[model samples]
Target chain A: MAVYTEVPDDELAAFVKAYDIGEVVSFKGIAEGVENSNYLLATTKARFILTLYEKRVNRDDLPFFLGLLEHLSAKGLTCPQPVAGRDGEALRMLCGRPAALVTFLDGVSVRRPTARHCAELGRALAELHETGKGFALRRPNALSVSGWRPMAEAAKGRSQAVSPELDAIVAAELDHLEATFARLDLPKGVIHADLFPNNVFFLGDRLSGLIDFYFACDDAFAYDVAICLNAWCFEPDQSFNVTKGRALLSAYHATRPLEPDEVAALPTLARGAAIRFLLTRLVDWLDTPAGALVKKLDPLEYLKKLRFHQQANDATAFGWRP
Target chain B: MAVYTEVPDDELAAFVKAYDIGEVVSFKGIAEGVENSNYLLATTKARFILTLYEKRVNRDDLPFFLGLLEHLSAKGLTCPQPVAGRDGEALRMLCGRPAALVTFLDGVSVRRPTARHCAELGRALAELHETGKGFALRRPNALSVSGWRPMAEAAKGRSQAVSPELDAIVAAELDHLEATFARLDLPKGVIHADLFPNNVFFLGDRLSGLIDFYFACDDAFAYDVAICLNAWCFEPDQSFNVTKGRALLSAYHATRPLEPDEVAALPTLARGAAIRFLLTRLVDWLDTPAGALVKKLDPLEYLKKLRFHQQANDATAFGWRP
Candidate 1:
């Protein structure tokens, strides 16, 4: 949501010269993508997104992320393809930051997801998983079940500042997830660990693209489904929209059938997903200074979702039929 | 750069439908223009800048701004033209803010202005004034000579915090300007009062376009030139580049010959122009909260420029020839 680094004009023109893309026509910093400074760079040829990887993102993960986009696009998934320069390198240094130019996809990200949008998202999510098989690169999900404890502990002292019961809720969820998460031996593969509504684009009812794959990593496939259910199936009033859940789940099932164990483990996976987001959002809420450029998303929103997931004892609660 | 408002997807789609442009292909919040939430809206037909006027901008003054763009574009200036909808209305409501779509111009703003860039900017500024000869609507410059004293007084109390000498300098400058600014009779017309380097664009060395007309108002044409000299002639080290000043004033004078009286008042107008920006920037520097999305510019930069202008008693100080 902010362009932290200001690329000099002559430097930009020189950098763009390395690529086969024609002369730079217009360049603008886009108020999009939280972790990186994204610019819409247009040339005589076409428009592309120029991303300067900020310090928050690990530079070592560049190959995996850039390669994954290349691999996914080759597999017929609609995603940004990294445009290699004349030197045959996709990732290079721009203003002392790891940078990449990606072909821009055209679509609008829905602010409020309809049931139809959810269904399209589910299909796309399943397709991403299906196509991401055998990528030959591995990155562990750093914010998964193994990472929740440290995150929660860091925010524990300051947790009560958000709400009186936030600390207790986080502690109990962490305990429950740590005991049950590793036990579930569901299908595992690469997943877009953060598939929020903002990450998926839609052209009317049709899903056009999936982006911000920096979070994509090896994880339980069903865990990604749980992430989506928590993300897209909830209304503004904090109630789960079962119709949206059905649309999302059914479409996903139609694309790639879920295993019996995966279906049975929905309640646990959903709760763990809730805790994953709750802890991170809580840390961010507590860490971000007041009046920072980036808008702090309320961690309590996930706390409310966690409360809802706590009572669901079966897949039926998520509109998943056997 | 920040996007203050988020336009919902459906609202954006319905809004674009009002115009004859095809369905929305892409919509992104642009981190450009401080007073408005600008989105780069792409349809099947073309790319356009959709500007939603935020609360900082006066809503009543919108007609004058939009109408001015239309008038300037009609006069063959390479400025953004306000695109009217099917109902022939360019200004309307979007997300409860006054909004209009203007054709997207192609160019990059030079971060470091060369003598060549300054020459191009001068020509473009002179062209804008010449083309704006008979623009019927008139909006008083709110940050001009008449507006400086109030702004200076607003920042006077806390001026010592910035520097012990700051308050005295502002006081002396304001007194000198108020005494002399009214005595000079100069050619007055519509002027792009805020023609900073960021407001002017270039494709390589060729001047492409000028934008951000929120500050355009009826004022002395030489005052606008003085504003440009203050903006474009200064180097990063706070030294005025006489070469750049010569290029700018020479090119501008070639376009619209400056009267001897107007040339003689360059030092005073330049001082007043420096005060205008210095006072407004001082207010912004003091008023903006820490960690705000909008970056606070250093007001002392203009203070240094004002000090330089204070010593210049003739146009020769600005590289003007008799």
Candidate 2:
């Protein structure tokens, strides 16, 4: 729930004049994206999402994100297409922040995703990966294997405040992941690093759109699959739901068959995914200021996930026999 | 920005199935209305607002609020009419909170309201009061003159922490207001006690609709006028803008002529209005738990407004003469 920048009425009117979207009928700040201020903008022409990119998003990466959306939408993938203004620029400035108007996608995000939702998500992920192959831009996943050690170091002494065993567990996992990640030469492509259920929208059982590409980067495609395994296949009690995992994996495999190496590396990649989230969530837990606007998710949730991944012997543990 | 209650998809689907609004195409939690969890629910038929009443709103008062919207909208006042379900009930349960779906009104809320906007607001306020006359419900203003003392007492010692002079000013104002309020016998009716800029929507320069009637009650109509004077006719620096006040008062008088006594009582009522907000905001400032989801509005802003109102003489001071 973020609307950090308040766009003045006259300023917003002026901003809308640049677009061909007609007179603003209704504009409302929506509790959608966390990384940016998102307004559900309705004009005489159509509905669009006006996003003011917050400080958390790197300005240098805006082009890559915008370009990827444009590329994906052009390739017939279901995503928000960046709408260009009369000046033919998709990105502009609003209230001193980098802003863009993207076509509004119609769908509701499922809170408790079922096996069908998981299957739909799996197919969408594979389609995204396949379509992303020909995209021109390349961005390294900053939260990938190489990034885990720095995040762990940042939360070193403070992580114990969240849990007594968190600090040691995180350190061991970082060392293990860092040593093993380089050797696992898995399929690499554009990966939606944070394709949580909240980011995937569904029209009943059908996946209508995927959103929040701020975390999209060039990484092992199977790693994206692993992220999904952690995000979509986990029960509220932190137990892995093999039924959901099998549904997700089977649907994904049917769309884009997983490489033999990619399948074999799933357990290690899943472990890395767990540690990545744990470290980031731990850092957020340690650093979030008291009385801050944003809610800090429990790091222990990811810690429980990490524990499960640590014990897994092969992809079979994830309900996928490779 | 509040979406405290997360509506699960299947539950929401089931909930929407009860309504005749067609299949749900999209539903997004909107960053509007702090008192309730508001979602912009778009279906195959039309767009509507799905509001889950939070704990802050009294469940007992839900009928009056919903009924008032129904009555007002029925009387041709442009507002969100509560959409009744197949059971003919507008009020129902969702996530254990009293919930209702209302026809979505279209318009944008102005961040910085102009004199024209103030005039439109004035006419609309009068229309609301006129239409609310025959409504078969009564809710006494809970934050009126009689209610100030209790709220002030709740924030007694803590008031000074917000400002050095707040305690003394609040105490003195309470004494002054208690003595003066009963003497000023003014026109009484249903009043929109909270008509701040955010609660009123505009299409270009036209007043589109009035909303958030949680504070609506049976009170002095002029006091409601005073609330608008304090809300819409004030500059950001807390200075009273007479031009805007004149526009607002004149437009309101054109729609519903103010009685001589009601006109004469504007100064005291405006002072009362200012103190009413100051006390409530101060209480919220004092009682809000640290790290709570809602943002605590600064009581100092209302403190400044109260000081301005205390110095005013009569309706003439508000750019209207009895």
Candidate 3:
């Protein structure tokens, strides 16, 4: 379940009724997250998803979560539009929890994303970020410099393999990251913090929609690009898939060419991004959920990935050959 | 906002009221996850984290997360133990969510962990895994084998960075990972799936506590070691931290020596671990929470990390002299 909150069916029905969409047909629980409770709903008008505000989600932030989608969608980005309630509100109380209904996207999440796909996503994401500047709400970065250290604190132990040199390297890198990226000139805007493959829906070879805007917040635009380079261009062995990297960057560049400063900051930002996930995932891994099909993600994977970024010397390494 | 959940204060009070150790304090959210909602509470007698089973939390699998902590704690591993409710059940219910309160650890997470810290973590993890055998429960490795393909599928079109050359390399590496590690001799047991820095807490120079055991599952023990090499032993720029790496591996070995096969598989396993995180994180990045504090992590860093591992011909690359 991506949503950890529990909302009864009847309450969900009432919640949907508040929305201006047509009619509700059926709704059932679709457990697919290690965090929240998500349900797929088929309305007479269209299919939609109903996410209950779960434990991993704060009820107070529902407006940002729901409003961001609405804001982005309004700006012409193809994303889920949150349904407002009877009082012209996007949020509603369901089963004693905060919940909302969103338009169900039609395209399937691409499994075989191509260079073209990456480029398209890059362009689309840049446009989204640019347009998001006009959004009615504002949110601070969720995984910025502040969050990284605390997460590292969470995964300090539980390692069965220890290497002194390894510790020194990470410490040095952290210092470098703190010092270097601290002063880089980069664009700051609303970024889709979690720009992974599964969140993007494609119609054929084209990116049809972007889903899951929960991590959207104000941060460096280059960070998003770096994140895309990492997410779209990496293979299962943690190696840089240059072909994919080039395509993603090219597409993004077409939309918004990266400034030299942003490009220069890529390596360090990349490390910071890797460390952010490694720490968070490690913390999450150590603490399992009571009942769910979610699996513990390996944090070390990001650790090694961070190491790779540290040694990278060429922009071409990320698959950009120009 | 650290904890994404709420364990009703009264329900938590009722559950803890029966505990033999101490007084029950109000339950409060801990707010530091993309998965579970954790709460820190004060009992008249002790401090504990009250976890409300979130959507991602499985009520049935409560034993694995809760039990492992107890088991590890029992064996002198510093970690939080699940507190049973008045009903003789480790799982409790509050506000319609399955809940349990775990012992509050008395240590802060280390910000600048040293090689000695890595070594201590390695020993503690090895001890935990070694003593975790023959537990009353079992869980399959969810992130193993079949998981990769699905992630690759989601990333296909978007992996523009994966040139044909890299694709071939990645494909070959995956095959090698399956074949090379297939027949390796190693002990299997419940291991901490995520051994990053934050999960383990420290009291000054010594290791004080480990928290968050959500991803603890049955798998190869050395995989945990490989995970550490990838996590605790790396510099931010992906450089190998020898001092910390040695300390970590040495400590782990002292507790549980590695088999030759496990040693041979170390590089590949480390690579595989990197890939695992790269894929999952990439997937998540694409589907970032619509309105949550969770940040989008970098995937490029891992890609670079994988490349380094691919070129790594010596254990010393990981800061290990052995």
Best by DockQ: 1
Model 1's alpha-carbon lDDT is: 0.91
Measured with DockQ on alpha carbons, how good is candidate 3? Answer: 0.01
Ranking by DockQ: 1, 2, 3
Better of 2 and 3 by TM-score: 2
Sort by TM-score, best first.
1, 2, 3
- Each model's TM-score for chain A is 0.98, 0.98, 0.90
lDDT of candidate 1 over A1-322, digit per residue (tens): 8888888788899899899999999999998888899999999999999999999999889999999999999999999999999999999999999999999999999989999999999899999999999899999989988899999889987988899988887888888888998688878888999999998988878999999998999999999999999999999988999999999999999999999889989989999998888888889999988767678888888888888888998889998877
lDDT of 1 by residue, B1-322 (tens): 7788999898998898899989999999988988888999999999999999988899889999999999999999999999999999999899988899999999999989999999999899899989999899999888877788888788887888777888888888888887898677889989999999898889889999999999988989999999999999999988999999999999999999999989999999999988888888889989988667677888899889988998898999998877
Instruction: Summarize candidate 3's per-residue lDDT along B127-182 as a digit string, tens digits.
Output: 88877875778877788655776776776665554333434555666677677655
All candidates' TM-scores?
A: 0.97, 0.95, 0.49
Cα lDDT tens digits, model 2, A1-322, are 6777878778999999998889988888888888888999998889999999999899999999999999999999999999999999999999999999999999989888899999999999999999999898899888877778888878888776888887787777777877887678877888889999989998879999999999999999999999999999999999999999999999999999999888888889998888888888888878888777677888888888988988888888988956
Query: What would you estimate as the lDDT of candidate 3?
Result: 0.69
DockQ category of candidate 2: medium
lDDT of 3 at A306: 84
At residue B108, candidate 3 shows an lDDT of 42
- Estimate the lDDT of model 2: 0.89
I-RMSD for candidate 1: 1.3
- Where is the poorest 10-residue window by lDDT in model 2 chain A? A1-10
Point out the worst 10-residue segment of candidate 3 chain B by lDDT.
B24-33
- Candidate 2 versus the native: TM-score? 0.95
